[model samples]
Each structure stands twice: as structure tokens, then as C-alpha cells.
Target: MKNIYLLFGICLAAFLLNMALIKLAVDLPEFFTSHLNDLLCMPIVLSICLFIIRSFSRNKGIKISLFSACSLAALYSIYFELYLPDNSTRYTSDVIDVILYFSGAITFWLVQGMEAGRKSSAIKKAA
Candidate 1:
């Protein structure tokens, strides 16, 4: 859907901009540098995944369920926050990051639903 692609583009652009700011040493707020990526990660990743699933299944009307989204957030939290921190020094455990991941997932679900609703309404109006 156009809305999904637009949301994905905006989130991806924000993530890239955040990374660029960090790389350029822009000295922004701590949240922008540290937590923004975590917040945007799921929406960006999940949108792409959903698009691929829709394309392959030939079902543009399909949407990711809330349970699936939250489950993914939980899995990411467990692996990246709980498991990786213990196994690798590159990762650190952060409870806030877990919250952000869920927040992003919910955001994706809300946007997806909005798009679906609009499509249904348009169909109804045409009929």
C-alpha cells in the first residue's frame, strides 16, 4: 500500500539521518542518538517484511496482526537485549529499547489499519 511505503520511507529516512548525525558528530540530544533507531527499527523492518509477504502471497489486503507484531517485539527484546548483551560486548541491555520496539510495532499496526480502512471505504464509495 502507498501508506505503508510512505511510512517506511519516512522512518527509514529518519533512521538514516540519525545515523548520519552520529557519524558526523552532530552533538544532538541523547534520545536522538541513542533511542531513535530502536524506536524506528520495527516499523521500517516490519513494513518491508509485510510488503514482501503481500507480494508473494498476492494479497494486498493482508495485514500483520497485533499479536504477531508484539510477539516480534518480544523476540527482538529477548535476543538483542537479554541474549546478545551477555554474548557480545557490542550490544547492551536496555529496558527502554524493549519498550520502544513495541511502540514501533504498534505504530506500524495502526498505520496499516488506517490504510486498510481507507481502501475499504473507497471501495464502498465506488460501489
Candidate 2:
């Protein structure tokens, strides 16, 4: 079903965005690296979750998926922190990441609801 595609998309976008952010970190100065991660994490995760939700269903499914995405992001963050060879370990633990996780989750849920509402109304009109 489309929901399956949504899940896959969530995973893929997260992977790619994280990769890109990693690359950006290398180019950024130490001063910018920490704050940049903070500002960037939520929008990237939320964007993916919202896109997936908009592409699929409008029900609680979207909310559940958004929450799942947040969990996955957190796990991925922890894994990368402990496993990945990088100087950014300190940046990962910054409280900003935690806030980003929740902000991203909530933003996605709201975006999904709004988009789903639009789709539902459109479908009703066509019917």
C-alpha cells in the first residue's frame, strides 16, 4: 500500500539528509557545526515525515508514522554518536537534537493533517 511507500520514503530521506548534513559539517567551522545541526535536524526530519504523510493516508496512520520517524531518528542519532568515527560526537548530544526530534515530529503531524484535509476536500468535491 501507499503507506509502505511512505515508510520507505521516510527512511530514505532521513538517510540522505543525514549524509548531506555530515558533509556539511565537514565544511563548516566548529562554531557553526553545533548550531547548524540544531536548526537543520528538525526541518529535514519534519519535511520527510510530512512528505510521506502527504503522499499516503490522512488518518492516525500518519501520526503513528511521524512518531515512528522520530524514534528512528533518535536511534539513528545514538547509533551514529557511538559508532560513527567523527568529531561531532559532542554536537550529537546537544539538547538541541532532542528538541529537534520532538519539533520535527509535531511539525510533521500538523503538516500531514493539513495536507490530508485538503486532499479529503478535493476528493469530496470530485465525488
Top candidate on lDDT is 1
Error of 2 at 42 (Å): 4.5
lDDT of 2 by residue, 1-127 (tens): 3443464466456556656876776574553444444434554555555557756766544444566757866765665544453555443445555565566555555555666677788899999
Looking at model 1, report the run of 10 residues with the lowest lDDT sum: 51-60
**TM-score of every model?**
0.95, 0.46
lDDT of each: 0.93, 0.56
What clash count does candidate 1 reach? 0
Error of 2 at 116 (Å): 1.3
> Which residue pairs in model 1 clash with each other?
none
Winner by TM-score:
1
Error of 2 at 121 (Å): 1.5
- Look at candidate 1 and tell me the lDDT of residue 127: 100
